[model samples]
Target: MKLVVQVKLLPSPEQAVALEATLHACNRAADRASAAAFESGLFSRNDLQKLVYAELKADFGLGAQPVVRTLKKVVDAYTALRAAIRAGTLGRPGCVRRVKAESKPITFRLDAAQPFDDRILSWQHDASTVSIWTTAGRMKHVPFRGNADQLKTLREHRKGETDLVHRNGKWFLVATCEVPEAEQYEPVDWLGVDRGIVNLATTSDGHNHCGRRLGRYRRWQARKRAELQAKNTRSARRRAKRRTKREQRHATHANHKISKEIVAVAQRTGRGIALERLDGIRDRVRPSRDQRAALSSWPFHQLGEHIAYKAQRAGVPLIEVDAAYTSQMCPRCGHTARHNRPTRDSFSCRRCGLAGPADVVAGVNVRNRARSAWVFVNTPVPQGI
Candidate 1:
């Protein structure tokens, strides 16, 4: 499994200035390269580099590797944009967003992240410091700190390029690490997870990670964001952006905690995890205007992602089961009806008189589906079936 460990850089004031200049110079070079690529319609890495490499090195005071990295960044940006357009994620062809995106060249911020290879960046794990090449000069012995696990991972499994990012008046290096997955055990059963807006997650075992508190926090943040936008000032907009980031951080933290607990339970009980296939959920549902914002902004997808990675790290098997009618279908009598759900919170079966919390009922349905699905998945097929 590939994981990224972020380490905080503690550079001296002079080193910080050098790093900042190097980042700006690289981004400026990238902007120039991107403009050339757009005008010439040449975005291939080698082609683009051939066109602008000399200019970037000579004009931008960047070294050989920085020039190479800058050109690669421009190429990657266009490649990603093309992919997004092809996937229809930017909207259909000739639509306003798609047209606008295709019409202009991609641009990077002045403080954009810069990638460094081993030749340009050297790490001294024992000294907890790094020596990085910059436009100003090579800065050596710049201290850094991270959690014990992050430091250990960086020392052992860190590979590939590390991105130097400047955000919120701080510098961080995100290093990629490849960690081996533990051996998966045979599952005695499955733990189903139901994801929803009101309840972030509810398991088949009847444990719930309620979203009431998070919901309130988000509502408060939303109200503040609206106020800031209403003011229509630069500083107000900046504050709103910071508030948005804070909310995202909080939601991410909550998900990590919830997923860790769920994975721990599954591993201890020798149970696999089953989650719903929730792709295209946004396209499938419609809600009132008031509910639309909340529904659209919900972090249900992030919760699922957290659960998946944590499960993989813990060597717990995980699968996605069909989610169609999970909430309304009765686990007891196989009765399926929209009327089975009397309210958003409660579920009742008309045929078998079975009842439970709506979310739990959905989770139980997921577990039942996984049990049957696993049997077919693992059973060996006879010669010709």
Candidate 2:
């Protein structure tokens, strides 16, 4: 499994200046490369490199590898933009969002993170320092720190490229670690998880991680955002952007906490985890106008990703089952209908009169599906007669 370990960098003032200058130069070169790619329709890495490599190397304050990284970054940005448009998540062909996105070349922030390979960056784990290439020159012996576990992971399993990131007022080096996975054990049973807006997750075991408090927090943030937008002042706009980022961080923190707990419980009990395949959830479900705003921006996908990665790291078996009618179907009598869920949080069977919390019942259905699916996966077919 691939895990990201972030360590805080402590650099001298002179080193910081060189680092910032290098990042700015790289991003400026990337902007120019992106413009050329957009205007000339040369989106491939090779094509873009051939066109802009000499220009960036001569004009920008960057060496050979930095120029190459800048070109590759431009190509990657275009690739992602194309994919998002094709995936229908952005909108249809004639939609305003699609038109706007296609109108201009992708741009990067001046302080955007840049990838560093072994050729340009070297780590000294024993000294807790790194030496990296900079616009001024090669800056050596920049100290860094991290938690005990993070340091251990960095020393033992760090691999591939590292990213030099500047966030808020802190510098961080995000290292990729190739951690070996624990051997997966045979599961006693499946622990089904139901994801939603009101309750972030509800398991078949009757554990619910509610989102009411987070919902209130987000709503308050939204209201402040609206006010800031209405003001239309420079400081107001800046504050709004900061608030938005803070809100995202809070939501992400909540997701991490929830996923860690769920994975720990599943691993401790020697059971597999079951989740719904939420590939196109936004298109599938309909919500009231009042609820639509919350549903649209809900971090359900992030929660699922968190659970998945944590499960992988813990060697817990995980399965994703079809989510259709999970809440509406009666687990006791095998009845399915919309009427079964008269209220958002409650469920009742029309024919069998079996009732339970709607989210828990949905989780139970997911567990049942996973139990059957796992058996089928491991079962072998008899030889043809």
Candidate 3:
């Protein structure tokens, strides 16, 4: 398993200026490479490299590997645009946006994992600082701080190339460390997680993490934004931006707490987690304007991602089951019908007179479906059938 640990960097004023200049230079080189690729219709990494490598080093004063990284940046963007165009998600390759000189994240990729192992990033455990090569031809020592675990990794198991990034008025070093996977354990019991807009998640064991507070916060934000738009003042615009950031931070905190609780529950119960495959439910559903806003603001995907990573870190098995008919089917009697769920929160079965919270019912159904899948995968076909 590859996990990325982000360590915050504390650079001196001069070093900060040098790092910013390096970022701008890298972006300039990326823009030049992108333009050349678009004009010449050559988008391969090798083609871009052949065209811009030497020029980037000579003209932009970038290091050798940074030049390659710049060309790679442009080629990746062009490749993504071409893919989207082919997949019909985008109209044409021209729809791709140009890399901004300062807006895009500025990164300096290390030469290899050897640099990290050799203490190029962490000079030594004694110093607790990094030696970064800059355009000024100077090796700057930038102090960094992180948790004890991250610091231990930097001292011992830090592997692969590191990316030094500047974003949101701070500098960070992102390093990917290879962690060994835990021994696989077949789950004896499964914990079903039903994710939806009304209830963020409901478990088969009768835990409901409703999004009512989050919903109210979003609605308040929407109303506030509307009021600010009506005023149309510069400070109002700035306030709106600040509000957006605050909302994001709040939602992220809530998600962290919710995912932590869900994982703790699963771990304590000695059960594997089962989640629904909700890839494109938003595109499939048609709702009223108010409902649309609520649905669009739902953080189901983010919640699922948090659960997945936490589960993996905790050595718990996590499986995603097909979501089809999970809500309509009755978990108790196997009765399936749209009328089973007449309201957003209420669920009732016509065949067995079973009734419960709609999300809880869905959770139960998800657990059963996951058990079925596990059986199908584990069972072998008999010979001479």
Superposed model 3: Cα runs more than 4 Å off: 91-126, 153-157, 231-246
lDDT score for residue 311 of model 1: 93
Q: How many clashes does each candidate structure show, in the order listed?
A: 0, 0, 0
What TM-score does each of the candidates earn?
0.97, 0.92, 0.84
lDDT of 1 at 135: 90
Per-residue lDDT tens digits for candidate 2, residues 1-385, read 8999999999888888888888899999999999999999999999999998999999997889888877888888999999999898789998899999999999999999998888899999899999999989888999999999999999999998899999987899999999998888899999999999999999999999999999999999999999999999999999999999999999999999999999999999999999999998888878889988898889999999999998998899999999999999998888999999999999989998898899999999999999999999999888993
1 against 3, candidate with superior lDDT: 1
Q: What is the lDDT of candidate 2?
A: 0.93
lDDT of each: 0.94, 0.93, 0.78
Name the top TM-score candidate: 1
Residues 316-340 of candidate 3: C-alpha lDDT, one tens digit per residue: 8899999998888998889899999
- Pairs that clash in candidate 2: none
TM-score winner between candidates 1 and 3: 1
Model 2 alpha-carbon miss at residue 352, Å: 4.1
